[model samples]
Target: MDMQSGTVEEALDKAAAVGVTAVVQVGCDLERSRWAAEVAGRHENVHATVALHPNEAPRIRREEGPGALDAALDEIAALAALPQVRGVGETGLDYFRTGADGIEAQTYSFRRHLRIAKEVGKALVIHDRDAHQDVLRVLREEGAPGTVVFHCFSGDAAMAEECAAAGYYMSFAGNVTFKSAQPLRDALAVAPLDLLLVETDAPFLTPAPYRGRPNAPYLIPVTLRAMAAVKGVDEDELATAVAANTARAFGCPPPR
Candidate 1:
């Protein structure tokens, strides 16, 4: 989540105390993507995913020019090829923030990121927000990568079933612990263990008991505990499965 340079080591230390041995630093734009790659290269426990966020794609086109957006996408493609860059994303449709006019730019960027993931043989991390059907439609149209994870998956049980059928990994985040998120809990219940993943989505969607506070990898156990309860499984059992699932999804070794 944008830990200041001076504080990153402390954050990682906190995370390790809770048995959280690995972190995936997501890059939403060129600057962050480059930073993520550098950080990943420096930290054995950290891996990176690079992309132009769904909203960022349109914002770039609007603020700069179409050429600028193209250049950013080009850079993302190059970053995706990096050894420590394990995926291409945080990219997909986001109708909640972007207007209809931005839809075309977002779609084009999503397609490009999807292609980049496939080309690099890396995971495609999707950021679907208020556009589930379109996200599925686009994935079908473009053909998804071998490993596709719906980061901070927000879909319901039916959508979870759809994802399960496609063998897409559904990663649950801290928001799944909220009282208003029974639908998410329901989705978690029916989701296959092999397809399950847990994320902090840090600095946002902090779990209950810590809601309104900035989230971090250390808080992953909080969300994992909640997820285990929803799935009616042992906490350690769930954690083990999630670790394997994450490794499989990103084509990396499971965090020890």
Candidate 2:
């Protein structure tokens, strides 16, 4: 909701009315992470994940000097310990946006976030974009946390199977509904029902019919329905599975 025009409270209200039992708002930087934590604190149905995004890593290193990235990681580690913080992420590799010059910093930041997630005993939410092999390599090397979720999963069936084998959760976002995303849909089909999740990734990746407009939690049903169709399952069944999977992924009980 931070990306949208309305207040967090209003977003929560709309989400609840539309059958969204809970929402996990992720932070891409220290300031936004704090804001997410504050929002989570104010709403029972909301939770947060704190991290420094891969793209943000290089910028911080360049703008704030070399050691500044370490300082920011320390702050992220501290935030991960908060009760309202359920995960440490939107971290991981993003070679598409970070470029070769930033890869080193991104890798370092990703490793630190992974350690923090394990240390805090929280879920690790990853954002792998065009750097899947490196992301998997780091996870294998460092050993992933008890719960790992690839948020906005952008991989093929083989990759989905690999993640499933590693016991990772694959979260499909609104992009899954796009006609050009048949490969993503194929991956969704191969993903085990027990390991499936759906997200809005709003106010971005809005589902079709409303693709160009701003997205919010209430629009999750649009993505969920699309996923269910791709998986050849009833919408309600998929909804139930997603709820259970989400709770498991975040290491939290489903909201009453």
For every model shown, what is its TM-score relative to the native structure? 0.98, 0.98
Q: Kindly report which residue stretches of model 2 are placed more than 4 angstroms away from their true locations once superposed.
A: none
Cα RMSD, each candidate: 1.0, 0.9
lDDT of 2 by residue, 150-229 (tens): 99999999999999999999999999989899999999999999999999888899999798888889899989999999
Give each model's whole-structure lDDT. 0.93, 0.91
What would the per-residue lDDT of candidate 1 be over residues 30-122, giving only the tens digit for each residue?
Answer: 888999899899998899999999999899999998999999999999999999999998999999999999999999999999999999999
- Say what the RMSD of model 1 is: 1.0
lDDT of 2 at 103: 94
Ten-residue stretch with the least lDDT total in model 1: 1-10
Strongest candidate by lDDT: 1
10 residues in a row with least lDDT, candidate 2: 1-10
Q: What lDDT does candidate 2 reach at residue 66? A: 74
Residue pairs with colliding backbones in model 2 are none
lDDT, model 1:
0.93
